[model samples]
Target: MAERASDVVPSSAATSHSDRGRMNIGQVLDVLRPDFGGITIPKIRFLEDKGLIKPERTPAGYRKFSVADVERLRYILRMQRDHYLPLKVIGEHLEAIDRGLEPPPIEAVVPTVPTVALNSDGLPSAESFARRSDVRLSRRELIKIAEISEELLAQLEQFGLISPRPGTGHYDTDALVIAQTARELADFGFEPRHLRAFKTAADREVGLVEQVVAPLKRGRDSAAQGRVADAVSEIAALSVRLHATLVKNGLHGA
Candidate 1:
């Protein structure tokens, strides 16, 4: 597809800018090579063929890429490498940008870690850990982002290590974390079945916390609800720290 005439600067104007600002195909390669080691001239041409980018052409037909074109290529490469997005999806993003609309959010494809502050001892603070994330991922997205196979995800669901939201059928941030962690554990020969004990322990801790918070919830007052939230965060952090310490001591003794 041909680029819009307005998209290309006139040849007369091109010569007026500093030579460093405008780049030929080889110069574009040199600029992008440090960050994208695999980029090649043919790759750039392929993107043009797909109509994802359109560098201007000189009278002799040599491709003349503007700085904007180079940045557009960078965005395309980053989406492909970091998010595993296909060319079709990247094209949609570029179209959105061209139309002056915000690109669709990618949180579903790349779940963001919740912002959390740490304590003086380098452990996450209670309030920080309590911050809820609204990120929701489809089953396929979860598998791709976590780099796990369908079989592993099914096994995780079977063993109760990760699950979708109750009704929406979308996995949340917690599920994403569990899935990624399970994938890493598989490297050490740990299977989903072996993680059942962890689920059981977590349930026990949750139950204990619920018992303490139940009274505050019963009050149903705004102040009571606030207290309940604070209590849960504090208790959860303490429980995690205690669990970690016990495991460390046991490993040292062994």
Candidate 2:
């Protein structure tokens, strides 16, 4: 379900700065940070590290927050509060919005995959058929897609299945793909203990498949999406028919 915009838009503690030049950055952060769990100066640096906030540097290279920066901070807060999103997801969400695209639904965009049980002819079960054919994920995103408990992620990492990179809890896209693969392997009697290359292979594989989904990931309005989906469906159907002819006949042979 889509959250109401108000539920996700950060509220301003801004005193309506008519003079954007003089707002003390720390004062603004303090007023806004408390709502986000007593956030401190370190949190600001962390958010900066995550690239969610970009403050101006003074002549001496000190950070300075303008009105715009404050709003961006508020946006960061809203993402964490309303979406329970990791920094990477939230950062990209804000970036797309700033670039004039609709933010992709956080839950709808999990990074995965494996072959489910094969049916008679070396194909996945009907319930797990093609999976849009190119679902990709990392170890971290696999957990997110599965909606598994965080404790499970921690356990996987404790076994070195994946690492929470640096200071951010956000998993790399590679982690998501690997995790999904690991889950599938686990079903076939492989465990995190068995796959040394799961993590690295996932990172590499996800990039290869992600190129296909990149176009779909571009955000759009409903009407625009409907048009694109219709076109894609039509093209896909035509391609399938074209495949039948090529497979069975001598039209335009190679």
Candidate 3:
């Protein structure tokens, strides 16, 4: 979500800035850094480019942000981090806020995946379907809930079966499911060593898709990158279906 204009000036930035109800972008960063750990200059600039925020420009051509700007950014960041909502949906939410209407709760934006069903071909709906804001668990939390020891987790990480989100030191729900499944497999005498085949197959599939999208991703434009992402996603979903079909065929001696 991009930052939106607001009338109420947050008190924190108001007292700090000596200028006319505005703080330079640096000060705004400092004020927001506590809540937004990954906030960067480029991200702020992108938000401005997206028309999420319209900071006042100084005569010296410096960007100056008001107290409302800070609060608006905070709101935008929270909506993104907590809800994983697409920017369009969040933009609508912000528009509601601008109109003095109470926006729907963030949960309203989450797509509810049905728990059970199979198509005529016996394929799952939305294979490999994990929502963007799926469960985020820390290392310790995952270890405890998945009933896996630290040693097993270390092996899983070593084998690339599971790893934390880059720089976040946390695993998503998919990692949790993988860990639990690995533990169940271990009960049947399967070790992490046996899982290397699965990992290798996954890496090969990923490489194939990366090859297809590499050229599309070369462009720096958002639309081009979006196309690359969409291609990767479609390929991943198909890969899941392929794997499931192959396993079913093997079990049926086809």
Best by TM-score: 1
Pairs with backbone N, CA or C atoms under 3 Å apart (clashes), candidate 3? 3-52
Q: What is the TM-score of each candidate against the true structure?
A: 0.56, 0.38, 0.49
Q: How accurate is candidate 3 locally (lDDT)?
A: 0.73
The regions of model 1 sitting more than 4 angstroms off are 1-123
List, residue by residue over 1-254, the lDDT tens digit for candidate 3: 33323333565545566355678888888888887899999999988888888898988989988777777777778778977867788776666565433455554532211123445676534434423533456677678768899999999999889999888887766687789999999999999989999999989988887888888888977699667666776777787789988998999996
lDDT of 2: 0.58
The best-first sequence of candidates by TM-score reads: 1, 3, 2
Ranking of models by lDDT = 1, 3, 2
The Cα local distance difference test for each model comes to: 0.77, 0.58, 0.73
Clashing pairs in 2: 112-136, 112-137, 137-176, 137-177, 138-175, 138-176, 138-177, 139-175, 139-176, 139-179
Q: Show model 2 residue runs off by greater than 4 Å.
A: 1-12, 18-22, 110-254
Once model 3 is optimally superposed onto the true structure by TM-score, how far is the C-alpha of residue 113 displaced, in angstroms? 14
Model 1: per-residue Cα lDDT over 111-181, one tens digit each: 23333357888666797668876656678768987899999999999998888989888787778888998
Give the root-mean-square deviation of each candidate in angstroms. Answer: 12.5, 13.7, 13.4
Tens digits of per-residue lDDT for model 2, 111-219 = 2233344446532333332234323333444576755556656667777777755665545444554566666776788756667554565455445544544576576
User: What's the CA error at residue 224 for candidate 2, in Å?
Assistant: 34
